[model samples]
Target: MDKRGRRRTLSEHVILDAALALLAEGGADAVTVRGIAARVGVAPNAVYTYFPDKAAVVRGLAEHLLGRVNHDRFTDPSQPWRDRVRALALELRAELLAHPGSVHLMLGHPPDGPHTRAVRETLLATLADAGLGPADAADASYLVNVHILGSVAFEVAAPPGGPDVGTTRFRWGLDRLLDGLAAHVATGPPR
Candidate 1:
């Protein structure tokens, strides 16, 4: 309140929250400093105090979105590991599809943030449950990641705004790929 003028922390969180809300409501393009400020009941400059640009806010929102995935239904420990992995992938794909523009923000972003690291760690842990060793876990985790991202990209890019193949066909694709991938897992440490 002194030299800072505005309550920057509260303003930043508010702005980030507004940005996510905007993304949820109108996809990526809807998120702007002005839009966030309007939603947060603050001036645009207040939002600017937190984020230098729309892109920075979007990156922060992307990180927030990744954090949500870590706690979502897909990470259920009661579910079998393979089932959990598939469900998580499907859930994430669905979320991205539902949001649309977040798909692009997600795809090319660097995996350097905390939320991203948590998601990756969770994924790697799930892969280890599938009997992958440390090295195999890393490799297979990345492979499965690529599959999920690639699949989601197609889902987001599809003309129907979702996959035309449906869940059965889509899951079938995962099954065929996993069947081969699991062979490598089975050979590793033998469980």
Candidate 2:
């Protein structure tokens, strides 16, 4: 340990940065303990000082990428609820599309940090502020995030990558969901 005795011997951040680069160069499959070690010019065992396995590395990458997006797009008191949620959805969609590999990693792995909870909590709080009950708020949050992930997966798995099929479909579906939310918001409340 260093003078402070606080995580001085290892640098998880460096590993994460290198792993992200490898992810961009290829995909999740391109990241391995040996590969990352080579990328960082460290011994293979050096990786185990931080991560336990390849999946753990991917999990870290997922958390890093997800955390980079502005989850606060959900709960900005400055914007109206409909516009806030729509903007949140669209912004998140664009981020995921830019890093399709991270989306895949997130879909396969469970979230392991406060950053992930922050994302969901932001969405949940925004829905509550918009007058949804807890159960309905949860469902609405699920609807938006799931569609984003599902749409990205479909795009990643598809071919003929020139038609914009996935982007067009996801945008249309997201707008329809927003339309339903607007109608609900207009009703004021259920009797």
Each candidate structure's TM-score, on Cα atoms with residue i matched to residue i, is 0.75, 0.83
Q: How far off is residue 159 in model 2, in Å? A: 1.8
- The all-Cα superposition gives candidate 1 an RMSD in Å to the true structure of 4.3
lDDT of 1 by residue, 35-144 (tens): 88888777788777777877778778778667667545556666777787787777666666666677677664443578777777777777777777778778777777
Shift in Å, residue 68, candidate 2: 0.9
What are the lDDT scores of the predictions, listed in order? 0.71, 0.79
Clashes counted in candidate 1 amount to 0
The number of the candidate with the highest lDDT is 2
Collision pairs in model 2:
none
